[model samples]
Target: MALHNKIGVLGEEIAVRYLKKEGYYIVERNYRNKFGEIDIIAAKESYTIFVEVKSRSSENYIELAQSLYHKQLHNIRQAAIFYFSEKNIHLSSIRFDLIALKIDPDAKKIDKLKHFTNIIN
Candidate 1:
């Protein structure tokens, strides 16, 4: 696989590990719909979370929050809704999460990790 693709896969793997460690029960990964893909779906408490994982080799001055754009958020929301509709899940406590990671390319470990919950507004 391409280096970028490999990096993304590794990032998702790390995100899943982190979420599990934080007491989230993973429901799915790489869920796709006609709209787009959700990197992870997890449950914690009464909420079902849809996560978007973004990875970079370095922070490189750009803020992770600024890196996520409206188009991407739109797709994630659409996909999440599609997933819920298909599953017949109608819980009011649905959440959108963003997990950003800066991975050390040489070590294949996280240099930095940030999780933002309820990102949609």
Candidate 2:
């Protein structure tokens, strides 16, 4: 589709790979409900993590993790609750995480990646 959309898809792929490397068992991608979407849903240890992935061409402009605004967090939380209820999952702990991916044009890989955990209430 559009260039920006392509970049976003790439960034999401990179984020999933990175999470897998970190030993997270990915449960779903682009999990959505009426409220909004959660880019990734993963499990590690005893916790279920809802992830938001942000991608940018460069980190020089802005910190990608900062892009997750309060409204977005609210939507994610709503979606997470819906997902939990629908899946019949009674998790003892849940977490929200943001994964920022900085793309490298030359290498066709992520230039930088940052993970911010427990980002929402």
TM-scores of the models, in the given order?
Answer: 0.92, 0.92
Off by over 4 Å in 1: 60-62
lDDT of 1 by residue, 21-99 (tens): 9999999999988999999999999998999998888663247777879999999888888898898978558899999
The residue-level lDDT of candidate 1 at 73 comes to 92
Residue-wise C-alpha lDDT for candidate 2, range 9-110, written one tens digit per residue: 998999999999999999999987899988999999999999998888867324676677788888899999999898997855999998887897557787
Which window of 10 residues has the lowest lDDT sum in candidate 1?
58-67
lDDT of each: 0.88, 0.86
Question: Quick one: best lDDT, which candidate?
Answer: 1
What does the lDDT come to for candidate 2? 0.86
Candidate 2 ranges beyond 4 A from true positions: 60-62
